[model samples]
Structures are given as C-alpha cells and as structure tokens.
Target: MDAMQMALPIVGIVAAAAVTFYAVSFAEIREKSFEDLEDKDFESGGFKPSFSSRQRRARRKADKEGRK
Candidate 1:
C-alpha cells in the first residue's frame, strides 16, 4: 500500500506532463505572412523540387538518350 501511494503520484505527474506536451504541440499558431518576399522569389518556384521529382527527370532523360 505504501508503494502504491508513491507510484500513484508519479504516474499522475507523468500523465499530466504528457497531456501538456501534446496540447502545446498541436495548438493553433498564426501562419507567417509572405508580404516580405520579392518578385524574384515568386518567379522561381517557392520551394525546391523534391528528390523524387529530380530522380524522375533524370530517368526520363536517360530513357530518351537510350532510345536515340
């Protein structure tokens, strides 16, 4: 019974901490405004191509050369 009393508080503290962590993690935050970006930034793709897209392009080029 003494051990149970000690363990109960420890478990409650851990559970409270986990709940707080998740609540903070998933809380809604404001989206950043893009007004600071220059025209050139928009002209280029806002983000870099993913690895899969780059690999697909390389494969297509290779297939075209193979056909030639």
Candidate 2:
C-alpha cells in the first residue's frame, strides 16, 4: 500500500477516539442553573468601608496609642 493509504487509517482512528472522549466528557458535565438566592440579614448591620476610610481609621488608632 502507498504512504497515504497506510496513514489514512491511523489518522481516522485517532480522530474517532478524540471525538468519543469529547462527547463522553461533555455528557458528564452537569448543568447548574437552578440554585436559590442567598438570604440577607438586615438586622445584622454590616458596614462596607472604603479603602481610604480604613487606612485613616488605622492611622488614627496608631497615633492615639503611640501618644499614650
């Protein structure tokens, strides 16, 4: 047989195996689009401070402690 004829079967076998693997993996991956939203507690009173505000608070505390 010629080089082309001999290589055709090998290429086809590899391609078939790759396609089978991809199909199996895709089927195994479950869909996740039906989850409940998180419940927020309004009474807890959470504060989200800015970066500058946090730095200023830390600096003030350090200054007050250093003066003692």
Candidate 3:
C-alpha cells in the first residue's frame, strides 16, 4: 500500500509527459501539413530534381550526342 501511494504520482507524471509529447508532435505535423499546403502555390508542387540527377542526365545527353 505504501509503494502504491508513492508510485501513483510517478505514474501520473509520466502519463502527463507522454500526453504533452504527443500533443506537441501532433501540432508540429499539423503545422507542417499546412505549410505544405501553402507550398503548393509553386509550379512544380514543391518537387525539384536533385543536382546530381540533373548532372547525370546532362552528362548522358552529352555522351549520346557525341556518339551521334
């Protein structure tokens, strides 16, 4: 019984911390979702080709042209 009395507060504290963590996580996700929604105002919908991929494609195109 004495242990239970001491443990209840600890359990409550941990539960409250978990709830706060989840609430903040959810809020961040929601904020990011809204930010992405706003980002769709761009032409490509927030998609951009990586620099290395573009460089590789350009190199391949040049090689093909040189072979021709």
- Compute each candidate's TM-score over C-alphas: 0.40, 0.43, 0.59
User: In candidate 1, which residue pairs clash?
Assistant: none
> What are the lDDT figures for the candidates, one per model?
0.72, 0.72, 0.89
Which of the predicted structures, 1 or 2, would earn the higher TM-score when compared with the native?
A: 2
- Lowest summed lDDT across 10 adjacent residues in model 2 is found at 30-39
RMSD of each: 6.4, 8.7, 5.2
Ranking by TM-score: 3, 2, 1
Q: Is candidate 1 or candidate 3 better by lDDT?
A: 3
Kindly report which residue pairs in candidate 2 clash with one another.
none
Backbone clash count, each prediction separately: 0, 0, 0
Off by over 4 Å in 1: 28-68
Candidate 1 C-alpha lDDT tens digits along 1-68: 69999999999999999999887766632112333333236446774535698899999999999999
Candidate 3 residue spans exceeding 4 A from truth: 42-68
Q: Which digits, one per residue and each the tens of the lDDT, describe model 3 over residues 1-68? A: 69999999999999999999999999999999988877775566565545698899999999999999
* Inter-residue clash pairs, candidate 3: none
State the lDDT of candidate 2 residue by residue for 1-68, as single tens digits.
Answer: 79999999999999999999998877665322111112334357643435698899999999999999
CA lDDT, candidate 1, residue 18: 100
User: Stretches of candidate 2 above 4 Å error?
Assistant: 31-68
